[model samples]
Target: MMLFQHHNTGIHLDSGSTFHLRTNEDDFKEGSLQGIHGGFHYASNVKGRELYQEGIDKVFDSVCKLDTRASDNVNSLSNMVQDGFDVFMDTNRENSFFVTRNGTTWRFGHHCRVPQKAED
Candidate 1:
């Protein structure tokens, strides 16, 4: 499994198969998953169709749960930034950042700076 972002949207790809999840709803509306059945058609032939469906279902469930947690983390970070926290990107690690809030520090990866709170 690999997680990455494109055009400011998160994507989770299963390396074993062509199955993937997109964070943006628009990606689905735009038919990003249109040809997915065709890609996995052979899997049903090799494995029973029921087994293939079950495996895909499991992967889909896991991906959905992961995406939910990621979204929650992002929201929490955004709130912190709004409440005067500062996030500095970590140069040593890709997609990592140092988040400081009221002198308490935490590190998180797969996210960078959150938008600053608007002035009154």
Candidate 2:
């Protein structure tokens, strides 16, 4: 959501224009884990559910304010937040979401976390 706020038009970082750097899945998931790891809520708890809904609402409201014309579709900021949250909660380390100057493009990708073993 913050990325869209800064780069609503989605320009490439190397285009000589300033834009937020993309976050890989590993880093993003790790950060999110660190943020909520101390919490005592699991998926079945009322507090966990409340916190989840609160986060969704906050993201929705923020996106609405930042991108006035966006909607709950793939091309909209709100949906991006929704999907990102889902992926994060699922601990999906293989998928990453990013935007490009070309437009809002959500692509599935993988981040290599281990070095390849060469055959002897």
Candidate 3:
């Protein structure tokens, strides 16, 4: 699959943005795969989730960040390192999600939760 990052928004690139150039958001629709979003978690915690989300977000999966135009979200994210998330700092926003088309099927990253497997 092709891998790259959006120039402006800095969102991760995947097979979805096959022909995209500018990246304020996944504004251009590249078939049905344009909306595949959030499939992983940051240690399943806020900080871990946020950075990890940011790490690969803009370059496998296509996810966005919805937060303060200034500082609130960043500050909140900092607190999450120690105290974890409060009521307001709920997991990332759904708006940052993405949709993508893969062949005859559509793959949604955020929508597809990683499977749970228990082992001894």
Candidate 4:
């Protein structure tokens, strides 16, 4: 599990599975892992609301892409997003949720129960 936090914003990653060794037969000499399951949460003051919401929108978009590509399985990417949220919030059930990818490029998605307030 990896956790990164700065002030009221934080990210938590839980690599659920182990890395598998890949041989030349698979075209790679080194081993590779699949992906991560995690969640992100942020709280900002009123002054930072616009920027924070923009960030949240980006995350939400990424998750939607992952969900579309994910298969119907317990360990699917969408599930990973939810799992990450559960872990980060330390709750067994749902809360405000966001999904993000790791590495050089990043993407995100969103799932939230509460209605977002209108922009000023």
- The numbered model that scores best in lDDT is 1
Better of 1 and 2 by lDDT: 1
lDDT by residue (1-120, candidate 1, tens digit) is 133321333332222333233333333332222223333332322352211111111211222111211231122334335547586775665455555655544444443332221211
What's the CA error at residue 59 for candidate 1, in Å? 30
Kindly report the root-mean-square deviation of model 2 from the true structure over all alpha carbons. Answer: 16.9
- Between prediction 2 and prediction 3, the one with superior lDDT is 3
Give lDDT for model 4.
0.24
Give lDDT per model, in order. 0.32, 0.24, 0.25, 0.24
By lDDT, the better pick of 1 and 4 is: 1
Q: List the residue pairs that clash in candidate 4.
A: 38-84, 59-108, 59-109, 60-109, 60-110, 62-108, 63-108, 63-109
How high is the lDDT of residue 81 in model 1? 52
The 10-residue segment of model 1 with minimum total lDDT is: 51-60
The regions of model 1 sitting more than 4 angstroms off are 1-76, 92-94, 111-120
Better of 2 and 3 by TM-score: 2
Q: State the TM-score for model 3.
A: 0.16
Instruction: Using TM-score, give the best candidate's number.
Output: 1
In the range 27-70, model 4's lDDT, one tens digit per residue, is: 22223212333422322232211111111112212221111111
Instruction: Estimate, for each residue in 1-120, the C-alpha lDDT of model 3 and write its tens digit.
Output: 222232333322233221122222333233323322553332212343222112112222322332222121111222222322222211454222232222111212333332111111
The parts of candidate 4 lying over 4 Å away from their true place are 1-57, 61-86, 91-112, 115-120
